[model samples]
Target: MSLIDLSKHVALGIDIGGTNTKFGVVNHRGEVLEKGNLRTDEYEKVEDFIDALYEKVHPLIEKFGKEKNFDGIGVGAPNGNYYKGTIEQAPNLPWKGVVPFGEMMTAKFGMPCTVTNDANAAAFGEMLFGAARGMKDFIMITLGTGVGSGIVASGKLIYGHDGFAGELGHTIVKPGGRKHWSTGSEGSLEAYASATGIAITAKKMRAEFAESMLNQYPEEEINSKTVHECALKGDPIAIEVFRYTGQKLGEALANFVMFSSPEAILLFGGVIKAGDFILKPAKLHMERNLLPIFRNKVKLVFSELDEADAAILGASALVWEK
Candidate 1:
């Protein structure tokens, strides 16, 4: 009889996005051995998606000496429930209703699986290998197409009873304010803090300033990226869009600071690429809103993980966590 080699351990990490499903083989040290992606929207049925995933992934597992050398599979998906091992009511995904995603993965891959919402997975990754490392309490806020958040307190994620906790983005920051595009919720932080929100702000604000650089692009071409470009060129309207977005974000952060009193708030995703244009305003407003005791106590910073690989690394961190 031969003993298993524990030193060569690895895990399969999968990040399921609305457009693509990225998968990777990751070692304990957070290095991605290899990675690939497939179109997520192509499959209409959950069963077909799982089968396609198996067909594509099985060979990679075999290349790493099959399942014996692997720890397990870790997955991050929209609305994934760690406790229930399901994905329930994810609006962007083709699958409607509750999907037994973790169970299906385990059945197809012949391995144990751990699943969590994409935001939570990113938080776990931050805890294990990114900026939040060595910090027991912190919050991870992803400012992307839509705002997403994960809260960690007392060294653990706050899953609440329903496993749907830590949805800071949906919290209302203003009464009778901007309406969310999909959720239809008015005054939610996501309405003003996401990349979508930034674009919307730019579009509306640009009309008043006829000479604004934003007027150069047609309304359809006006997005967060173009706004950022205009801001780089010292356009006042474009800069104001980021300032307004940051004010909303900072106000929300103030509320978050009071609720959990985290050591830091780590910002991640494309929206943060604007750098100081957004960050300085956010920091200023956050401090202004905070109480004297809570002021200057919480650190606001960017995540240390590489954006391109953060999702994969985050999902892989789940396996190590378990």
Candidate 2:
């Protein structure tokens, strides 16, 4: 990729998630020229998974090559390591251990391949093509199935010494608080701020409030999406749940801001689509929690990228990273 003229060459971006693997051929402007997805859970072996992915992605590479030169490949996956190009002990994936993901993809595609965790990929995408396009210093927090983060400072993504720098989700906001099932920890931000966390919060509210509108539906039906719908419809229970969740998230962001003093904190993913239901509380709480010196100095905002193209574009943007 170093030898290739990036201005004239397009890149392949692949985002491998727990349920599906999405791939896209994208130009330098962040436009996705071609895109597709494969079911990720169907493959039991990592090798077979790579093979299937290559089969689906290669045709697009070939077709697009006729119009533009293919530079390289970029990948974003759970627990992906940018320095090592490996996926390390991802809890949800069927594949186990530290798999040499980048090398395998490079071999199959006959090009350079870069790998990073999904949040970092999204952060890079935002920097290159979305809201943070001109900003060098910011934190990108993803509020989805699980909370994730990517830290940027001085115009570079901070990978830390171990290449797993931004695990803001695992940071404990409350000591000895609610237990996170996967990490088995107490009061992790992921335990209180993620979509999964919101569901947990909803459950707790249902137990405490006998007349909750959430009680009108089955317990399993009271997910984040439904909670948002309920909130929009003036459901007291749902609004309270979001308020609590936003308090946890806002406090966490204030702590992060103290450490990095970022220009902005960008929120991404489905849960953020709740808009003011989530943002208003989060912004208010974040400012309140900040120190007097830092008060109201940082911007808290939602991502500008199209959710459907963001992951793929972010992965592809890795190729352009210095």
Sliding window of 10 residues with minimal summed lDDT for model 2: 1-10
Model 1 misplacement above 4 A: 1-6, 66-68
Q: Report how far off residue 220 is in candidate 1 (Å).
A: 1.3
Model 1: per-residue Cα lDDT at residue 48: 96
Q: What are the per-residue Cα lDDT tens digits for candidate 2 across 1-322?
A: 3585556689998888899888889988898877889999999999999999988888888888886788889888889999999999998789999999999888877989999998888888888888999999999998989898888999899999999999999999999989998999999999999999999999999889888788888888988988888888898999999999998998899899999999999998878977887888888888999899999789888899855466678888888773
What overall lDDT goes with each candidate model? 0.88, 0.88
Q: Tens digits of per-residue lDDT for model 1 on 1-322?
A: 9975655889888888888898889887788898988889999999999999888888889999664488789888889998998999988899999999999889888899988988888888888788999888999999988888888899898889999998888999998999989999999998988988888899899988999999999989888899999999999999999999999999999999999999999999889999988999999999999999899999999999864366677778788777
Worst 10 residues of 1 by lDDT: 306-315
Model 1 Cα shift for residue 121 (angstroms):
0.5
